[model samples]
Target: MSEWDAEFEVESESDEDPDFGPHGDARIDHAVASGTFTLDGQTFDVENNIWVVGDDAECVVIDAPHDVTEILEVIANRRVIAILCTHGHDDHVRYAPDLGLATDARVLLHPDDLPVWRLTHRAPPSGSLHDHQVIPIADVDLRVIHTPGHTPGSVCFYAEEFPGYPAGVVFTGDTLFEGGPGATGRSFSDHDQILESIRTKLLTLPDATVVKTGHGPDTTIGAERDNV
Candidate 1:
């Protein structure tokens, strides 16, 4: 049986799932560790995950929420190495500079969303993030997949062996979700593009690949596939 049976009071497969814990934890090992914070008047469950593959300790932040103070409170103790933006929404990027200032970590983002970054008037620790670009932080190697659905610069970070699933996991941001996927409503975002990105970038991962989204709860490629 899946880990769902261990922690959750899931009655049946038909029962509605609340919170992203089950799928989220399945992707992140209990030892992996995570932190939560609120942003944009909304609460974002930010996960401060550490990886072991390099000399120094490295971490990856799923979404840069608007509530910098809360996020700071979340990972106050851990050493952050990198910041990953699920998409270039105002709420998500609002705290990028604040977090960057606090952690001194490199900010990773797609070139297409540079406009959103520019609005902040802050330069990323590194530079623009590209599709399929593999960046190394502390001890983590994050593979960037430009999943532009919510925005043109949306991307997901994938790391192998850091979480429960041996094959690794993917951070869906706003592009993909537990049941179906996120909507593409921005003026610049193309509905067709977002759909295509999921089909190619996210769903292409192994069935066991867990999806950690920007908002709401978490789901897996396998679990969502069955529903889709």
Candidate 2:
């Protein structure tokens, strides 16, 4: 049932990293949305993970894939401060504009991925996301880490420390995944560059740094360091 077809498949929401419960200091929520991903004249079905980070009052939604309703449902009544796209891939940013419209929140994407972004959306991004930039959520912040190769502007959001929450977590799009980096064989993607990006940017984080990905289950930097 957790698929993104016309049905807008809805799965039972999963809790944040077990340690970071809904009421826990981490204050994160997660959902999976499905839809077809189209690019370079080809399209395939995909299921993407949607990350919501905030407290009782407000929050930020990450990777607005398939369903805006689902995203909003997860957001509940909290004020949506922003919609952050890890990259400009259609699946990740597809529902961003819809979500922004529904919540009156700005949608942010790195400038470099505009070309890919335009393949799906005509209007430019609501705002730009840049390297080392700090995105303030309720209390903690996500420091941008520009890790291209999945797309020229692919980036990750690293949340190091916030009161009451565990330190060291990164939100990686398709640049890196559980086993290793995802498909670079696609158009506009690179193999070596992504590996290098992972090497210098992500792997350098602490071993316990949790890697919140754009698709599938969560992973850790330490679990991926030796494998990738």
Candidate 3:
């Protein structure tokens, strides 16, 4: 087993109901769960959000944190088409390979983060995500926005009028958070780059755009625009 398998634990499971929208095409169900893991002797909490779009039987998974069991349970009976990582952080991607294998789903990451991914995962991802790339999951088309800084390959997935989200939703991995942009104290992290990313890529979105962060509660593009 990889060190990831031995070091992480599913601390809890909390299921939130999917937000329903007006049109059937916009009706996407989603659930969020969290897991805990230790890296370099420090414990970190990670959140994994699963989105069920189109036929409701097919789905896309974002940020494969620890607790594969919980993630599996959340996606039970559904066919996962893709596993999209926001970046290459171990805390966010530790279970991606196993989860992808279990679901036979394609794993995707930014090419710039391949080195970070190689630090923990032995195999390369199924593909690479680039700016403005559109990922079709069921009836939804998630637009990839490459927001570097937190990591060279950090990205955020954006979809408009998704389910209960009228304005839109952006799955911001560790790049942009509720309070401010993600930390830049680690290797390959740049404060200026992250700030510029937030300004040009994220903050430019509509004010009401929902910011589904990788680790905490959601925020809006407007809320963090001032901070940026």
Give the winner by TM-score: 1 or 3.
Answer: 3
Ranking by TM-score: 2, 3, 1
Better of 1 and 2 by TM-score: 2
**Per-residue lDDT over 95-157 for candidate 1, one digit per residue giving the tens place of the 0 to 100 score:** 677778788765656668876566544664244556665644443355778887667888887
Whole-structure CA lDDT of model 2: 0.81
Q: Which lDDT tens digits does candidate 3 get at residues 77-184?
A: 877867889999887788889999999986878889998898778998876667776666555667889999998999999987576787998889888888899988
The worst-scoring run of ten residues by lDDT in candidate 2 lies at 3-12
Arranged by lDDT, best first: 2, 3, 1
Q: What is the C-alpha RMSD of each candidate to the true structure, in Å?
A: 13.6, 10.0, 9.5
Instruction: Looking at model 1, report the run of 10 residues with the lowest lDDT sum.
Output: 19-28
Pairs that clash in candidate 3:
none
- For all candidates in order, the CA lDDT equals 0.59, 0.81, 0.75
Worst 10 residues of 3 by lDDT: 8-17
Off-target runs (Cα >4 Å) in candidate 3 are 1-55
Query: Is 1 or 3 the stronger prediction by lDDT?
Result: 3
